[model samples]
Target: MSFNIALSGLNAAQKDLDVTSNNIANVNTVGFKESRAEFVDVYAASLLASGKTKVGDGVLTADVAQQFSQGSIQFTNNALDLAVTGNGFFATVPELGSLETSYTRAGQFKLNADNFVVNSQGGHLLGFPVNPDGSSASVSLSTAEPIRIPTASGAPTKTSEVDVRMNLPAGDSYIAGAPGNFDPDDPLTFNNSTSVTIFDSLGDSHVMTYFFVKDDPNTNPNEWMLFAAVDGKPINLVDDSTVPPSATGIIGGNVSGPLQPTGGVGGARLTFNASGDFISQIPTLADGGIITEDFTNHLPNGADILQRVQIDFNLDPTGPNPNEPTQFASNFEVTALNQDGLAVGRLTGIDIGTDGLVRATYSNGTSQPLSRIAMVNFANEQGLTQIGNTGWKESIVSGEALAGEAGSGTFGTINSSALEQSNVNLTTELIDLISAQRNFQANSRALEVDNQLNQTILQIR
Candidate 1:
């Protein structure tokens, strides 16, 4: 009985030493939680054996509980490194497409060869799918999936619509020096001109310029000729309205005033009232008030942009409005110039918000919402089972994992470019190590004394 009691004391002390040593060894491990060895006094009681006092047999090793306190955060240059400030853990999978989930506090992550976000152990990071507006689609653990970054170049989109708003100077001489003769080469031929860049199906860009030729003021006071060109080639707005808007001359000078479009060339007539308000156009706007800028064979790169690039002056056909382009007596100014077109862009960088939304920015001045970093919390964090690699698995003691977006409800906010260090305290671990060693030595002496007394008893017999 004495031997058994002494043996149990040694084992308990050894367990304490082992636990302390492990804590000290992993002091620098990221996301490592320090553990403490608990012990209980052992004793066997027999009914009616002792009425006054009973002695405890020895110490028995009990549970080793892990401490789940917050760790210090270390900022890094990598944007993928993440840290949680308050509560929650990052969930991951052992491999891509594998549902076997694991939770972790280590945020040392990077993009793999396939552009997938993974940890040092190659476990893929899981996240919730996001909408285009950067909102999480679902916060269920079952809906979580491995996050994959898109590194490939983004496809280009054609210039389908364009909005133009400007003021046609009413103070400028409609017929300055000579009758209006539309000519892109000579600035004197047109009063004002503006150019816009449009993209083709192949992602190539071409300059589409609009030339406004103020008509002879005396004969037609509020009239002008509208001509368009693409890449220095005249695009007939009428006949070539569909394809190959090939034309030699759009409009020529009429010394007597009025409007005269050169033969084989097409031009739209702009009419306005004396109040400088827009009244109508020669060939009124089509069904949707769209001016089809056709450049069929004019495009050298073989882009069939026939009636594809439509222009909207942003004018209200219902009645005269202040927002519409006006012949105001002021300097020519383009108030609004917008186009819905995109060029093939390369991935520039990534940004992760505090809410765990991950978005990718491109060189084309465009951003896309990728995913929301999934945050998970367990009811009993101390009850988790350690599976190495600074990761934990849900055990029976720990409640089911609760999935939610970061900064939502009880979930902690995600800190990007930061890492959570180990929670172990070296000073405390070292002190515990010394105490356990002394306990082991003292237990050995007790066993030695018990052995000596037994030896004396044998000698006397």
Candidate 2:
């Protein structure tokens, strides 16, 4: 009976040591959960011939239960590196040989040679696929699928309207010989300019320049005029400001200051030609201090305003700003464009969000969401059986898998450029190992003593 007890201790100790060694070995392994060897004691049972108590004997290996505690998070620069903050696991279907869905907590992923997002084993991360319009669809991937970034987002259209915001100083004086050396006649020339590269309906690029000219060199502080030109062609300004060109009359402002002197700051209206070039019409009094320029004056000046040219994609084949728009409720407006827009662009890069949303940005002023990441969870996590390579297989005990997006329900947020390390703890394992070693040594001593006693009895006999 004593020998049997010693043997049981020996077996249990060896198993415990094996568990500790395994934990220590996988300390560096990502997503590895340490396991514990459990033992059950057996009691002797005596059969009752007449009326006797029954007892069972010895101890045995009961189970090796894995600890599912989360590992400490480590930061990796790669955006594809992912980590689970809370619960749930990453699902990957093996690509080599037989196909089987495996679950893992490890999120060390990289883009494959084929440009497909994949893990070390080439298994693709599954998620909801997206359409060109940045909408998602229900789908799953067996491996990381190749991402598609459009070369040219779309063809350019006509320029409808523009918005600008800027600061123009009214510090300069209107009278030259005056105390401030004010010279309202010579308005400030607009040299501070920006260009936007816009594509024509024919897919041709045209640079547009917007010039801001301040007319009120003195009094009406914030008054300024605007000028627009495309490829150096004046498009919106008038030919002459003094004389009326057509029935539209003179678009210049009424004369304000002295008769012979060039128009002073106050009465200036903005005017431009067909090519978008602009000029300001200043009003000067004809000796009688009479207001000359009126509604016919087109070069209207106002407060210092920042100007911007924006492109409105009118998908509607119908006329501009159609009453009822297509696809989009109205029309997608891309504004605050310089010259025209970013140089004729191509798709350049892609990124994934914590919620598993994929976005693609283009060299042009265009961007779209590509997809959403999908996460799966199991009911019985402990029931999951290991399939090597830090992957797990679903067993009858694990129940069915529940799928959803990150931050939804029990799913954890996806951390970009990070990976989850193994949950194995060396500290606890070392302590457990010492206890197991002592038990093994004591069992050995007991077995040796038992054998010595048996030998003495034999010798005496």
Candidate 3:
């Protein structure tokens, strides 16, 4: 019985030493949780003679409980590296195994040659996949696919309206040298008009030119006589009467003079028809409107004139004025402004939130959620059977698993670009080692004393 007692102490001390050694070995390991060995005293029971209590037999291993306390976080420069700020595990699918999903607190992730984000063992990080636009969707991938970025997107667009802005040269001569028409330094001497191209929903082009021959150039800068034309035909858009006055032009608006003038005086009113022809009372102003000084293309309604034209039509068509895109039945709002109405983006980096949301960013100032990671928590962490490689498997005693999002319920948030170091305490381990060594020595001394007593008895006989 005494020998059995000493042997039990030896076994218990050996187990204590082994557990300490494990802690020290994994001190630098990521996602490693320290553990403590538990021991139970064995006892013999007699069913028939029940009196005071059963006699003690020896010590036996009860269990090894893992400590789940969070470790200190260290910052890492790698964008894919991660650490758990709170409580949660990173889900990864191992490559060589059955590709079964496993959870861990290690967050050291990296991009492979193919650009797929993966862990040290090439396990892929699950996430929601996104289309060209930084939108979310429920998509799954077995193998990590390289991030794909697009150059441009195709959107609905057409020539809608044109904006005209320019400063006409002040030094100018109308009709060569018409009376009150020549001034080199004074801005009140010339007339200014502008033409712009507009496109309909069907992409048809139209040229709208406003003729502004200063009625009173010296007095009214804002109060100019405005004449409008389309193609080469005179268009009385404001009133629609009296054949736009041909060479005499329409006599309307604030005017301090007449339209007709002498030769070389360059007082001309031009009209452009939608059919792309320029009818001139005189040629269009060379440097007074939207066109270039040498521009001979007076008609603004042509395919060639709208090669780079973009258009946005207002939907209200009424007060809002500009054309609007036709709305779809769904909740999506469609808008048009240029070449393609689609927004642009480029791949920048990736991130994983505590809730297991995989996000991707782009150079075009866009972001998208690719996927959500699933987590599993066990009822009996101690019941988990070790499978080496810092991994554990489900056991019958561990109970069913509880799976949910981090920071929600019992699960915790995950920190990116960090790893969890082993929770081993060297000071405690060293102290425990000393105690075990003393106990081993005392047990050996007791055995030696028992042997010496036997030897003395034999010698006395």
Candidate 4:
């Protein structure tokens, strides 16, 4: 009996030492939790035996409980290294379509060959689908899916309209400086000229130049001719509302076709009142500004010939305060000039918010919301069964896993570019090691004393 009791004590002490050593060994492991060995004393006696002098049997190992306390965070340069702040775990799967999952605090993640976010062991990180407005589509665990970043996004859009706002030099000041005629090559024929970049269906850019020429004061008062050129080639304007859709424009009520560089052909007309205020337009300014610049015969590239660009000059008396073009006495200046178009874009960068929402930016000045990281928590964290790789699986002892977005409700916020260090404390484990060693020594001495007493008894007999 003494031998059995001493043997049990030695076993219990060895168990304690093993637990302490494991804790010390994994001190630097990320997301590692320390464990403790618990023991209970055993005793057995018949009901009839004297209760006052009862002795204990021995010590028995009860449980090896793991400590799940929060660990300190270590920041890194990688944005995918995530850490849970208060409560929650990062859900991961072995592959892309596998429903079987493992929960972990180790968030060292990177992109695979296919651009799917995966961990060091190739476990895919799960996330929730996001709406166009950057909100999670669903918070249920059933809807969580692997996160994948698009390598490229966004499509090109052609230029349809250009808002042009400028102050045309008053009266003859512009005409006086250069009085010959409207010649783009000479720069003296037109009073003022401005150029804007426009995009085609294929995202090809071309220069659209607008030349403003003061009309002959003798033919029409307070009138100016508007001529346009695309890619340095003169383009014709037309009013489809006319009887036969007469040529491009009407100068002083006369229709002309292709505008000539000598200032004698087709050119849109702008009429202003004696007070230097815009009042009317020739060939009529359509409901939404005039549209007549046609690329039917002048596009250099293989762009669609039917595509036409409209120059919007709100020639209205009551148009929004700052939208209409003014013929002020100031120097020729383009106050506002913008085109509605977009070129094909390339992926630029990605940003992850504290709420685990991912957004990607493009080179075309556009941003798109990708997905929201899924956060999961268990009712009984200690009841989860360890599955290695610093991950755990839901067991019967642990309740069902609950999924939610980070920073929502009681869920902990995710820290990107950081990792959670091991929770084991070296100081405490070293002390435990020393104590367990002393216990082992004491148990060994007891076993030796019991053996000596038995030997002495045998010799005396």
Candidate 5:
């Protein structure tokens, strides 16, 4: 009986030593949790046995429980390295199409050849589908899917309109040849010129230049002629025969006849007030607007039909508006230029927000949500079974996983570009190791004493 008791004590001490050694070994491991060996003393007691002097039988290992304390976070250069600050685990699937789920705190992830996010073990990280606005589409665990990032966006779209707000110098002199001699190639033909690149239906770029030539200062002191051309090809606004030039050979000199309209064979005219404030636009379109222009055969190979672009002067004759262009005496400058067109862009980088939404950025300065990482919390973390690779499996003792978005409810915020280090404390493990070694030594001495007593009794007999 003494030998059995000593042997049981030895076994229990060995188990304790094993747990401590494991904790010390994984001290530097990422997402590693320390474990403790729990023991219970055994005693032989029955209904018929007297309780006055019942001797203990031995010691037995009850459970080897894992500690789920928070681990220190180490920041890394990799964006995919993630760390949780509170209670939650990163759910992953061992196989691509498997329904079985495994929970892990190890967030060292990378994109595979297929662009799917996976861990070192090739386990696919599960995440909730996200809407275009980066919001979670659903919160159920069953709806979670593997996150796959797109390498590029779809085809490009042609630019239909360009909104520009700029100030044209109010004190500039008129062109050398007036309106009839206005040419894009000659700098003296136009006072100020601005160019913008526009994309066609085939995603080809074309330079559209706008020439601002001051009108005859003697007759129209506050008027300016606007000429537009694509690749130096003048856009014909109207037939020159209908509205002939004035006696002075200038288009804006006459205020009557077919040339009465500000825009005819010449470019659109901009009229300003004496105080350098924009007053009105001439050559109004059929819709009573002077801000739009229609250009035919704009592309080199007729890649697209008529290219209609709206030149937004940003003038709102209504109340107070700061975006409107003013005729300030300052040098000609373009304040803002924007166009609604896109080109084929390659994937540049990825960003993971605090809400666990993974957004991929493209070279075209556009970002789209790829997926939202799913965070899961178990009712009983200790009840989870270890499945190696620092991962855990839900057992009967551990209730169903509660799925939710990161930073929502009790779930913790995700720290991107970081990794959660092992929770094991080296100092504490070393102390526990010493205690277990002492216990083993004491148990071995007891066994030696028992063997000596049995040998002495046999020799005396």
Candidate 6:
């Protein structure tokens, strides 16, 4: 009986040493949790046995429990590396469509060959689908799916409207050429010119130029002629035969000649008051300050696009404080220029928000939400069964996982470009190692004493 008790003590001490050694070994491991060995003393007793002098039998290994305390965070250069600040685990799947889920605190993640976010072991990071407005669509565990970032964003949209605001120099002399001598190609014919790049339906770019010519200052000091052209093709505004002919074609009005079929509304006649303040724009200043023009025959791709392009000034012509083209003494300058058209975009980078929303940025300066990472918590965290790779599986002892987004309710916030270090304390584990070693030594001495006593008894008999 003494031998058996001493052997049991030896075994318990060995188990304790094993647990302490494991904790010390994984002190530098990411997301590693420390474990402890618990023991209970055994005693032989029956229902009618006397309770006064019951002797203990031996020690038993009760259980090996894991400690799930918070780990220190280490920041890294990798954007996909994630860390949780509080209670929660990152849910992941083995494959794209696999429903079998695993929970982990290890967040060393990277993009696979197919651009799917996965860990070093190829486990896919699961996330909730996000709406167009960057909000999570659902929080159900069943609805969580692997996160996949798109290589591109929305399709190209042709330019429909362009808004421009500028100030024209007021003190500048009239253009050298009169109305009849005005020519788009001759720099001396116009006082100032500005060009803008516009996109077609096929994502092709074209240069649209605007030329401002001061009218005959002797006869019309307050009048100015605006000439428009696209890709060197002059856009006619009026039907005056008095104007010089363009190399592309003869200039005509919106109602007659070659310009009529192109939906040209003719050039604008800007009129300013004596105080250099804008009084009105010619062609009756159409609704929304748009100048409609047709480019059906000028498209490079030959595809029929929305030929009618509306040039919007964004200033309300009827408003009391309308900001129109001003004729100031300052040099000619363009204040703002914006268009609604966009070209095909290439994926540039990705950003992860604190709320676990993943957004993808494009080369075209556009961004969109890709997915929202899913966070899960168990009712009994200690009941989780370790499945290696620093991950855990839900067991019957652990209640169902409660799914939620990061920073929602009791869920924790996600830290991007960081990793959660092991929770094991090397100092404490070293101390435990010493205690277990002493216990083992004491047990071995007891066994040696028991063997010597038995031998002495046999010799005496």
Clashing pairs in 1: none
Model 3: lDDT to the true structure:
0.50
Off by over 4 Å in 6: 176-182, 216-221, 235-251, 254-265, 282-287, 302-304, 317-323
**1-461 in candidate 4: lDDT tens per residue?**
99999999999999999999999999998988888999999988898998789889999999888788899999999888888887889899999779999999888899999999999899999999999999989988888899998996676778888898887777454365322356667677788889999888877788888888887676666777787778887665445454243233333324543222234435567777665677766656455365554566666678776677777777665643467676777788898889998777888877788899988888888788888999998888888998888999999887999999999887899888899999999999999999999999999999999999999999994
Going through the candidates in the order shown, the clash numbers are: 0, 57, 36, 3, 0, 3
lDDT of 6 at 303: 45
Q: What is the C-alpha lDDT profile of model 1 across 347-366, one tens digit per residue?
A: 99999989999999888888
User: Which lDDT values do the candidates have, in the order given?
Assistant: 0.80, 0.57, 0.50, 0.80, 0.80, 0.79
Evaluate residue 195 in candidate 3 and report its C-alpha lDDT on the 0 to 100 scale.
Answer: 56
Q: Which residue pairs collide in model 4, if any?
A: 181-189, 237-248, 238-248
RMSD of 3: 12.9
Which of candidates 3 and 4 reaches a greater lDDT?
A: 4
Select the stronger candidate by TM-score from 4 and 6. Answer: 6
In model 5, pairs of residues that clash are none
lDDT of 5 by residue, 1-461 (tens): 99999999999999999999999999998999999999999987999998888889999999999999999999999999999989999999977889999999999999999989999999999999988888899999999999987865645567776776778898787765577677678787678888888777766777877778788988888888777777776554332333332122233434342233233334667777787776666554332233223444456666555455656665556533566566788999988777777665578899998889999887766778889999999999999999999999999898899999999999999999999999998998999999999999999999999999999999994
Any runs in candidate 4 off by more than 4 Å, and if so which?
41-54, 171-186, 215-227, 234-295, 298-320, 323-325, 456-460
Candidate 5 wrongly placed segments (more than 4 Å): 153-157, 217-221, 236-266, 282-296, 300-307
Sort every candidate by lDDT, greatest first: 4, 5, 1, 6, 2, 3
